[model samples]
Every structure is written in structure tokens, then in C-alpha cells.
Target: MPIVQCVPNFSEGRDLEKIEKIVQPLRCKEGVKLLNYEGDKNYNRLVVTVIGEPKKVKDAVLESIGVAAELIDMNNHKGQHPRFGATDVCPFIPIKDMTMDDAINLARELGKEVSERYGIPVFLYENAATKPERENLATVRKGEYEGLDEKFSDSNWAPDFGEAKKHSTAGAIAIGARRPLIAYNINLDTKNIEIASKIAKTIRHSSGGYRFIKAGAVEVSERNMTQVTMNLTDYTKTSMYRAFEAVKMEARRYGVNVMGSEIVGICPMEALIDVSAYYLGLENFDLSNVLETNLME
Candidate 1:
């Protein structure tokens, strides 16, 4: 059995009714397990994690994407996170008995079908990108939804799937195949968004930070604080502890203290173990030393 993990992010997060409706398709589906789903009202985004046989997982994701398109109108959506579609980005990761090429093919198939079914222009990103420039998701989403009209008009910006035009309501989406990523956020005590943005620019890969980090800043109005949100693209290379420590170091420079930190969805157990080793000053500690890890096997 070829197992794959699919993480799909949608643009609506505040409405419980809509969120449940969108998630209903993946529930109790044979050969697919919905691992977790998280909604951040501040970001107005929903992140769902599911793992299963590749084909079954793809079908479940496709069904949920349809629900999102029917219910969410990108024109009326507002949030701190950058987005360009009702179903923003769907990524497939090969988990077991599979290869990168298999995931890439799954991404392409889903992207094509999504375009055909919903009339949403799709961009293939990460390992599934057809062009080098489209490989980085941030580069592809630079203009966002508001700038999609201008972006679509540009010859070089033609989508890999669908017509060279934006969806009337849902906007566009990016689908791809990639390694596991950790959606991590570090909050600062200060409400100053400029400080957070500066820290984000300093730490993200494109801005000369960690090679596997993709980061940005967002203000959590409800919490009266700002956050340095990140996607730790490759946790083995750039551990959560490293990113958290970097943020703490940067915050100190501005006389801003670290408020707290959070992981949006499920993260690898090894990522947390790395953090434990650093904070506890444990020498030569690893997952092998954890009791639960041994029991789970």
C-alpha cells in the first residue's frame, strides 16, 4: 500500500458551520484517516491533515475542495495570512511505500481535475512545479488575490493548469508534492507588527535566514501581540528549537520579550524531542530515550 499525507489549507476559518461542512467528506472514509484539522480565526485559515492510500486520500481532498469553493467567496474573505483562493494550497507528501515522483503525479492529477471541476486556475509548486520560478510557493503567491488580475495578465504568470484567468469567486490555488512541514509560530510580547515583520524577514530563507525556513509576520489582534509564523519545510535540517531560539534572540534586541509559541498542526515527534534536548541541556538525547516512542512501536 502506498500511503500519502495530504495537507490542504482553506481560506475560511471563523464559521463553524462551513468548516464542518467542508470537513465532512473526509470523515469515516475508507482507507483514509483524517488526522487533524485546525482553524485559526486570526489567520482566517483552516489546515487539515489526512493520511491514507494515495488515491483514496486524493478523492477525499478533492471532495472537500469542492465544498470550500461552493461555500467560500474569496472576495469577501479577510485575514492576516496571505491567500489567493477558497482552497488555497494542497500538498501531498509520500509517507510509505511511495516515492517523490508518485506524489508529484498525484499533485498534477489533482490540480488538473480541480481546474476542470471548479474553474479554478492552479499552480504546481514545490517538487511538482513545471517551471523553476514556480517552485517556491511564496514567489507564486507574491501578488495574492487582490493582485491576481494583474498577475494573470502577465505572460510569464500563466498557470500550469486551467485557463489563463482567475476564478470569478474562489480565486486560484497551488497544489504540490513536498516533504513534511511544521507550521510553527512564535509570539512576541509587543503588539508592534513592524518588529515582527523585521524578525520574519531576517529569519526566512529568501531573506538569508535558515535554508529550510519560510516565514512571515502576523498580528494577533485578539491576543494583542504579534507572531513570527513559519513553515519549517525540512525539520531535520531546521529544527523547531533552532527557529524558536532565533526568534527569542531577535526579540531581545528590540527589548521585546517572547510571549509564547505554538505549532498549528501535528509535528513529527523528533521535532519536539530536539526542542526538549536543547531546552533541558540534555547531552546525546534523542527519540530512543523517550519511553512513549518505544511503546508506540
Candidate 2:
């Protein structure tokens, strides 16, 4: 069991005691398996999921990003998802026989040990991109954290480690190594929200649409509704029943419909066995010939 799955995206989901003091260092880490959580107080963010081993899940996500860089300030952050840090966007996913160059060398050894142990400024996207325009984690979180102090005090976005700018309270972190991404969401019976923000710009992928999806559309205010959220990344190149039927066919052009769909954390088992083999034409299905998953080993 090589499994190294992490999915941390935290920007303090509406402060439940500051998200339990930023997940109390992964609840005092052991073999790290706190798998599943999804706050979303209107995208005040918190996506947490975990797994183990690759050095005990990278020492419990670098000690929960040093306790979310000592209780997450991100200069009085607000959120609608797009965040630069307060431990935002860590990735690392390799499941079993681990490789993606062993999660890109454990994401550059957890982004250079979270930029030399908490000075905070990491940014190493997609297969731990050292460059190539940072293999896009929203173009390395464009203009976020109030445009990140003139974008990392200019070394062409300086961070591959702590501070060429912003971390006065955990503001810049985005480590990587990829694959295994799911975080879905749907919700839409309509309260408009600009028809869920134009069906998240017609099914996200840098606004041209669907290429392993990556949407937006939000508004939940205690469920008044209007979402579309996504990440999907590869799900074997866009599956999850083709991203919930492509946002239920873009929420039926304004007459909206889909009111249930979510899965923010812990998603593996071939993403619910590839949506029950694309809605049940199960044919040659074989998950070790499933009999309660090989009857407890």
C-alpha cells in the first residue's frame, strides 16, 4: 500500500473555531487517514481528505502546513474559492505502487519543506512544475491574496519557496504532483445566481469548457442554492458520468434542474467504480471480482 493521496485546500471555511485551529495538525497525526471533509460556507473553503504512507502522508501534510501557518490569516482573507493560501491547493496523489515520479519526489519534498518550514511561498503546480508557466493551478492563483504583493515582489512570480512576498499569515502555498482529483458539486434548481454563473461559463476548463473539467458557479448561502463546483482533473479524462452529464447539460439552458450532486472528499474506488460503470451497463465489471471487495482481504 504505497498510497499517498492528499487534497488540502483550506482558506478557513467560515471559521468553525477557525476550522478547528486549522485541523489541529491533522488531528495530531499518526498514520494520517482523516479522509473526508468539505466545508464550503459559500466557498470559504476547506477540502481536506488524506491517506497515508509516502512518508506518513508527507508528515501529515507538513504538520498541517504548520498548523495552517499558525492559524490562517491570509491578511484577513475572504473567499469564494479562488485562494492563494492559508494552505490552499496541495495535491500529491498516487494511490498504490506510487509513481508520478513518486509524486514528483513527494512534491519537491513538500515544496521545499513548505518553504523552509513556514516562511511560506511554495507554488509548484501540476507535476511539480518548476516552470512551463506553472502548469496552471488557475495560472498559479492569479491576482489572489490581493494580487499577492505585486505578484511575489517580481522575480516573475518569485516563489518556489518562502517569500518573494506574501505569507504574513500563511498566504502563499500551492504544492503539487497530480492525478486523483474529484471534488464535485452540482446544485441547481434555480435562484438564478446568473443561471449559476452562466453554467460556470459553460462547463469550465479555462472557460472554453470540458477538458477534464474545472468549473466555478457558486452561491450557497445556507442552501439558497446555485452551485456547480468542480475539479475532476482526470477522473480518467473526465468521467463521473461525464461530469454529471456535463452539469446536467448546462442546467438545461436556464430552466435549471439538477439539485443533488456532491462528493468533495474521499473519492477513489475508481470514483465509485466509474459511476457504477456509467450508470449500470456493468458488463465486464471487475473490481477484483467484487464480493464485498474481496471479502475483507
Candidate 3:
């Protein structure tokens, strides 16, 4: 299958009706399967993941972006995570036979078209970064929504597409192409958000922590726990064992224990296989024997 994956972040997570209103279009979109939709209350973010034929995926995204512009306005948005738009960032990733260059081209095409149609400024990031500085997502999201006005004023931060000015309703978006990533988090057993925050600072990339780790801690209301959520950018480069162990080690110092961990959306089977091998002392174990390999199409 010439499959490409797109994960688009939209600003409205507070209202289920509103989310359903926007996602209704995806059900009718040809060649796209909504792998998952995970909404984070603290971050006020809804991440919609889908995989499909190139054109079908693009059409679905275009529709989603249009609905988001009409329904969401970034100026009034507030969340724990950094963002700059209603439909903040959209990324396309290669799966199986698809190549990174193919994903990059798809991202470029989407960025250009969305910019032209919606007037939403676009920044090409990660593997799709026009320059090395933009390769790191943390660098691009530094200012967040509050800093967009100033960021646009600087010549150095010129958008890859669209006008330097921000869109009245949608704000700006960072569209990119990247490797398969895992949205993994380890929630520490503590109500004290401070400890979780401190541990988060010590583990994320921006604070001189793990290089492939982009992370932060947020409150999970129902659980009443502060979670250290992360995007393991290159899980192949940095294993989940290392991530879990690192957090386990850091949380121990703060007098906290690992409550539990979660894989927010669909993660590649190799991640679990890698964790099993590391934890079970099966250094040479091949994952072909695992049933998950056959289960995930």
C-alpha cells in the first residue's frame, strides 16, 4: 500500500459536540481511516490521526482545516502546550513502502495550498524544514501563540508560505514531514504538579535533557494526576526503555513513583517489541514471533 499518515492538531478539545461537528466530514472522506482521535483536556488539543491515499488524505485535511477556521479562533485559545493556530500543525509521515521524500513533497504541497486558500501562514518543519534551524519543532514553537506577533515581525522568522501576517481566525500553522513517532507519557503518582513539572524539565529536549524527547507535564483531571507527556521523535534512536527508565530515575529523586504509562495513539509494533526485549533481557529476540506484527496492517 502506498500509505501516508497525517496527524492534524485542532484547537477545540473542550466540547465533544464541537469536535464531532468537525470530524463528521472524515467519515465520508474517501480512502481515509480515522485511526484515532485523542483529546487532551489540559492541553486543550485534539489530535486526529488518519492514513490513506495521497489525494484523499489531502482532501480530508483541507476540509478539516476549513471547518476548524470557521469554528476555532486562536486568539482566545489557552492551553498547557504551545500552539499558534486553530488547526495548529499538520504533519504527514511515511508508512511502509512510502518514502520520506514523498511525505515531504506532500507536506510542501499541503502547506502551499493551505496558505494560498486560507491565508494561514505556514512553516515547514522537521524533515521538511527549509533550513536546519526549523528542523527542531521546539525552536519553531518557542514563542507559542502569544509570541506570534513578534515572531512575524522578525525577518529571520519569515513563514515558509503565506503572508507574514497572521490569519484572523486560524492564526498560523507548522506543517511538516517526519518519521513515525510515539506519543508516549508516564504519569507520576502525585497530585503535586510541581514535582511533575520539575521532572518534565529534566527529561525534555529544550532543557538540555534527552535529545529526541519533546515533553511536558500536565494535569489529568479524572485521574487527578500530573502526567509527563512526550513525543519520542525518533524512537529508533531513543528506545522506550531509556525513556521509561529515565523518568523512573528522575521521579525517584522527586520522591514519586511511576503511576502508569500510556501510548496515546497507535504506535508501531517495534516500540513494544523493543521494550519487551529490553525489559525481559531478551537481547536477541526477534519480533516476528509476536502476534502484534500480524495484527497491525
Give the whole-model CA lDDT for all candidates, comma-separated. Answer: 0.93, 0.81, 0.87
Off by over 4 Å in 3: 291-297
Per-residue lDDT of candidate 1, residues 1-297 (tens digit):
889999999999899899999999999999999999988998899999999999999999999999999999999999988999999999999988999999999999999999999899999999999999999898899889988999999999999999989998899999999998999999999899999999998889988999999999998999899999999999999999899889999888899999789998778888888888888999987788899989966
TM per prediction: 0.95, 0.34, 0.94
lDDT of 3 at 290: 80
Compose the digit string of candidate 3's lDDT tens values, residues 1-297.
788989998998887987887776777566988888877788888889998987789788988888888898888898877888888889999986789999999999999898988888999999999999999877887788778889999999999999898888788888999998999999888988888888888988889888888888888877878898899988888888888999999999878999789998789878888888887898557877788776875
Candidate 3 TM-score, true structure as reference: 0.94
How much is 60 displaced in model 3, in angstroms? 0.8
lDDT winner: 1
Specify the poorest-scoring 10-residue window by lDDT in model 3: 21-30
Name the regions of candidate 1 deviating beyond 4 angstroms.
288-297
Query: lDDT by residue for model 2 over 162-244, one digit each (tens)?
Result: 66878777778888888887788888887678888788778777778878888878788776788888878888777878878
TM-score, cand. 2: 0.34
Top TM-score model: 1
Q: Which rank order by TM-score, best down to worst? A: 1, 3, 2
- Angstrom error at residue 203, model 1: 1.7
Error of 2 at 66 (Å): 15
